[model samples]
Target: MPSLPPLLAKPVDLAPLWLVERLARLILSSVLKAHPDLFERLGDYRQTRYRFSPADLPLHFIVVPETRQLTVSRGHPPVADAAMTGPLVLLLGLLEGRCDADALFFSRDLSVTGDMEAMLALRNALDDSAIDLPSTLGTLAGPFSALVAGAARSIRSRALAERHATWN
Candidate 1:
């Protein structure tokens, strides 16, 4: 496949942020509805702002725990209480609890900045919860939930495989 020039690639890369942002908000809303105590577990950090950056993509997401809002954009904010950065696969793996946080951090595949404590707390909370993105998103699909979940898993697997292939 021919690579897109930088000028063209910029917009192409940014396009997904819009779709991702909308989907993220919907998923978050469903998650909050299912788990009302999500914010309560966040404690003082409930009000803290967290930024998630996907290193391979031109995208960032600022999440406000208190408001239960997640804003996806093309760049990081001026400031964030805590920021976690990694490739999209690593981020998804962490989210799905399929990857070991400690191993990723130690291996430098993932990074955290600003409020370490808040990040740790967030990590702990995530660890305690059963967050299956595909299943979660499937729930929103109602009757087609299983099919949606299966497609999501398939897409994720293919993306991960492609990413791994590039590393070799």
Candidate 2:
């Protein structure tokens, strides 16, 4: 099989912005539905926009706290209350609790700009929840839960491995 990065690069780069945005919205809504606590915790940032930029990708997402929406776009928004920038792997690691946020921030692996309070609140809320993306996705997959979970885990592992290989 082709390595993950090379296989994904072309398709992801070629995908239309509208398609990406719609997919992101669907995924975000599903995740939020599976974990209502996450939405509740984000209530403090109601009506605010939190942008997430995966430094290595030509994409970014704006997360709306009030509506629990995630909109993917090609460029960073002109104005956002808070923005988190990093490689996708690092961001996923932070979300999965696989690494420490402070360490990553101190080491400059990840960065947060704009509202510090909002960022901290988000970090805290994520840490407080037991969010396993693959598991959540599996549950959302209904009867195909196991298959979905397996595929998610496989993809995650490949992505992480690719990142590690590049670093080393």
Candidate 3:
């Protein structure tokens, strides 16, 4: 999958941290609301701190499931029990179970560090979630949901086309 061009990502790097964090939290809250059980599978691992670092981006995202909290960081990403570093697209695909976590890790397209057990637990939870990211994001558009979804799906297809086809 293609990474966001450095030029395109520059604005995000320059944006205020609070703004980015707020937007991310909004999306996270929406997803949580849509699938309340999304993290239930994690059970005991739900309290673990996870960091998602997009290799193409300048900052990383921190998520605390038990607290239902999300934060963004530029210089400091905060402590995490586990961290996954990869392109934003691949990460999002994994969240929706549209990407095979094992394949990505084995192929070196993704990297996981810190607590392997916690990372695997998170993967298992995601695999069982049956999440549809475009649909979830589209709902944020309200009346334009269908249009937004179509565009998102189109973009997603394009992003996944050059790489693996298996949506594991």
Most accurate candidate by TM-score: 3
Residue-wise lDDT of candidate 1 within 23-78, one digit each (tens)?
77898888877777866888999998999887766778888999887998875454
Global Cα lDDT for candidate 1: 0.75
Residue 127 in candidate 1, Cα distance off native in Å: 0.3
Q: How close is every model to the real structure, measured as TM-score? A: 0.79, 0.81, 0.91
Residue pairs with clashing backbones, model 1: none
The most accurate candidate by lDDT is: 3
TM-score preference between candidates 1 and 2, better one = 2
Taken over the whole model, the C-alpha lDDT of each candidate is 0.75, 0.73, 0.83
Indicate the residue-level lDDT of 112 in model 1: 89
Compared with the true structure, what per-residue lDDT tens digits does model 3 show for residues 1-168? 556556557888788989888878878888888779877778888898999999888788988888887888987667898999988878888888888888889888899999899889888888878888788768988999999899878877877776754687
- The candidates, ranked best first by TM-score, are 3, 2, 1
Candidate 2 residue 54 Cα shift, in angstroms, is 0.8
Cα displacement (angstroms), candidate 2, residue 4, comes to: 7.2
Error of 1 at 89 (Å): 2.2
lDDT (10s digit) by residue, model 2, range 17-115:
898788677667776676778857865766668888877778888888887767787854546899888877667656766557787677676789998
State how far residue 42 of model 3 sits from its true place (Å): 0.8
